[model samples]
Structures are given as C-alpha cells and as structure tokens.
Target: MTLRHAVLAALLDGDMSGYQLAKTFDVSVSNYWHALPQQLYGELTKLEKEGLITGRVVIQQGRPNKRLFSLADPGTETLTQFITEPSRPSFIRDDLLVKVRACEVGGHAELIEQLEERAVQARAKITLFDKLLRELRGGTDEETYLASNSRIGPYLTGLRGRAFETETLLWCEQSARVLRLRIGSKPANG
Candidate 1:
C-alpha cells in the first residue's frame, strides 16, 4: 500500500499536527509500514492538495503555528475503495537475506554475527509492540477490547507486527545456531 493509505489510516485516530502524526507513526505505524518524518510531512501536503484530507492551522503561544490534518469525506471514501482492492503479495528484499545466501562465498562468521544482532533487534521490537498492545488494551481484557474498540485496525496491524518480529527472532536464532554448528564441524582447511 502507498504511504497515502498509511497516513489516512493514522488520521483515523483523530486530527493531529504533522509533528504529532510523525510521532504516532514512529510508535505505531512504523511496525507495519516504515516512513520517515519527512516522507510523512510530504504526504500530508499531497493529501491536502488532493482534497482527500483537510488541514487547519492552529496557533500556539511562543511556538510557530502548526497545521493539524484530518481525513475528509473523500479520504474516507478513498480508503474504503482501497480496502476493497486485492493487495499484491508481499516479498522480502532484505540485505540480510542476501548475506545469508552469500555465506557459502566465505563470510560465514560475519553473517552469523549479523544474524545474532538482528535477533536482538527483533527482540527489542517485540518488546515495544508488547507495550503498545498493553496500552491499546487499556486495562480491558483482550476479548473485551476486541469486541469494544471502535478502531481495531491499529491493534490488528500491531498484532501482525508482533508476530512478524517474534518469528524473525526465532528464524535468526535458528539460522545462527545452524551456521555455528556447520562452521564448528568444518575441516580446518578445505
């Protein structure tokens, strides 16, 4: 999906300034779709120009005025249309996977180290997602929250991210173990 759709999804929560939206994306949307702050700001302008979203300037004391954006009727309609269309299949284009493939060309040790580091990163993401899940739950039990929350899209996407990271951690650990075993058993010089 385009960043446009992601930004629309974010606005569903409520109207927010570009800064606020960027911060929200970092904590929430960054899990499923990564976009830099600059990219989000750019998209906000595009969306405004397209009339899909509306922005209003808010003055703040001792601070520059900021524009807050909210999804317009057209935006909601566009998002509905987008949801109906079949999504193209997703694929990984990861450098780490390329390195894994190249291990046979002589970087086994380095590759293994990289895999371990990736596992750590994955674990950190999982922890952050867990915290987000808790906040979304807001003291409500999972079943209650699922049944009651008007905006469940974020929660659903968050769950997907958590699962993805969890699986990534498992895969990295398994790959590292296999590589270590192979390296350990190999002849000293062959």
Candidate 2:
C-alpha cells in the first residue's frame, strides 16, 4: 500500500500535527510501514491538496503554530475503497538476506555478527509492540478487549508485527548458529 493509505489509517485514531503523526508512526505504524519525517510532512501536504485530509493551524504560546491533520470524508471513502480491493502480497527485499545467501564465499563471521545484531533489534521491537498491545487493551483482559473493542484493527496489526518480529529473531539466531558451525568446519586458509 502507498504511504497515503498508511497516513489515512493513522489519522483514524484522531487529528494530529505533523510532529504528532511522526511520533505515532515511529511507535505504532512503523510496525507495518516505515516512513521518514520528511516523507510524512510531504504526504500531509499532498493529502491536504487532494482534499483527502484537512489541516487546521493550532497556535502554541511559545512554539511555532502547527497544522493538525485529520482524514476528510473523501479520505474515508478512499480508504473504504482500498479495503475492498485485493491486496498484493509483500516480499522481502533485505540486504542481509542477500549477504546470507553468499555466506559460502567468506565473510560469514561478519554476516553472523550482523544477524545477531538484527536479532537484538527484533527483540527490542517485540518489547515495544508488547507495550503497545497492553496500552491498546486499556487494562481490559484480552477476551474482554477482543469482545468489546470495535476498533481492533490496530491491535490485530500490532499482534502481527509482534509475531513477525519474534519469528525474525528466531530465524536470525538460527542463521547465525549455522553460519558459525560452517565457519568452524572450514580449514584455516580455506
């Protein structure tokens, strides 16, 4: 999906300034889609120009005024249309994976180190997703939250992110171990 759809999805929570949107993306939306602050700002402007979203200036006492954006009626309609369309499957395009494929050519040690680091990063993301899951539940038990909350989409997506990261961590660890063993079995000069 385009960043436009992602922004619209994020605005579903509430109106927010560019800065607020960036923070939300970093914490929540980053789980599924990643975008830089500048990209978000640009998309905000484009969305406003397209009438997909509306922005209003909010004045602060000591800080510069900021424009808060919210999804417009047209934007909601657009999102609904997008939902009805079949989604394209996502594929991995990772550099590390490519390097791993070439591990037999040497640099296995470096690749293994990179994989370990990725595992650590994945674990950190899992922790963050767990915290978000708790916050989304709002002190309600999982069953109650699932039964009561009408807007469970974010929660479900968060769960997917958590699961994906957990699996990634496991894969990274396994890859590192295999690479290490292969390196150990190799001759010193070979």
Candidate 3:
C-alpha cells in the first residue's frame, strides 16, 4: 500500500497536525506501513492538493502554527475503492532471513547474534502493542470491546501487529538457540 493510503487511514482517528500524525505512525501505524516524517509530510501535501484531505491552520500562543488534517469525502471514497480491490500478496525480504538461509554455509555466530538482537526488538514491540491494545479497549474486555466498540479497525490491526511480533520473537529465540547448539558441533580448527 502507498503512503497515501496509510495517511488516509490514520486521519480516520481524528484531525491531527503533521507532527501528531507522525507520532501516531511511530506508535501504531508503523506496525504495518513504515514511512519517515518527510515522506508523510509530502504525502499530506499531495493529498491536500488532490482534494482527498483538508487541512486547517491552528495558531498557538508561543510555538509555530500547525496544520491539522482531516479526510475529505473523496478520501473516504478512495479508501472504499481501495478496500474493494484485491491486494497483492506480501513476501518476506528481510536481510536477517537471507543471512539465516546462508548460515548453513557458515557465519553461524553472526546469524545467532543478529537473531538474538531481533528477538529483543520484537519483545519491545510486543510490549508497546500490548499497551496500545489496552488503551484502545479502555476498561472493556477485548471480547466485549470487539463485539461492542464503534471503531474496531484500529484494534483489529493492533491485534495483528501484536501477533506478528509475538511470532517474530518466538522464531528468533528458537533460531538463535539452534544456532548456538550447532556452534558446539563445529570442528576445532575447521
């Protein structure tokens, strides 16, 4: 998906300045679509020019004025059209995965180190997703919230992110353990 679609989906949360949108992306949206602040700003400008989004200037007492954006009718229509279209399948293109594939040829130590590092990152993300999911559900239990909440899209996506990270953590830990065990079997001077 394009940054345009990600930005549009984010605006569904509410009106937000570019800064606020960047923060939102860092916290929640980054789980799916990754974009730098500059890219997001550029996409916001393009969306506004295309009439997909509207922005209003908010004046602050001491700081610089900010522009808050909201999705327009055309944006909503665009999203509807997008959702109806078939999505291309996603493929893994990670460097670590490539390294793991080559690990059988050698470099087990490096691969094991990278895998352990990835596991740490995954754990951090899982913690963050857990906190976000809790906040999204408020005091309601997940099942109750899923069934009764007015807005469930974000929550559902958050669940996917959490699950993805959980799998990542598990795989990384298992791979690292296997690699570490294999290290003991290597020849003394080979």
Off by over 4 Å in 2: 185-190
Off by over 4 Å in 3: 185-190
Q: Candidates' TM-scores? A: 0.93, 0.94, 0.95
lDDT of 1: 0.90
* Global lDDT of each candidate: 0.90, 0.91, 0.91
| Candidate 1 wrong stretches, greater than 4 Å | 185-190
Residue-wise C-alpha lDDT for candidate 3, range 1-190, written one tens digit per residue: 8999999999999999999999999999998899999999999999999999999998999999999999999999999999999999987678998888888899887777788888889999999999999999999999999999999999999999999999999999888878878787432223
- Name every residue pair that clashes in candidate 3: none
Q: Which residue window of length 10 is worst by lDDT in model 2?
A: 181-190
Count: clashes, candidate 2: 0
Task: Give lDDT tens digits, candidate 2, residues 40-149.
Answer: 99999999999999999999999999899999999999999999999999888889989988888988777887898999899999999999999999889878998999
lDDT of 1 by residue, 54-167 (tens): 999999999999899999999999999999999999887789988888788888887888888999899999999999999999999889999999888888988999999999
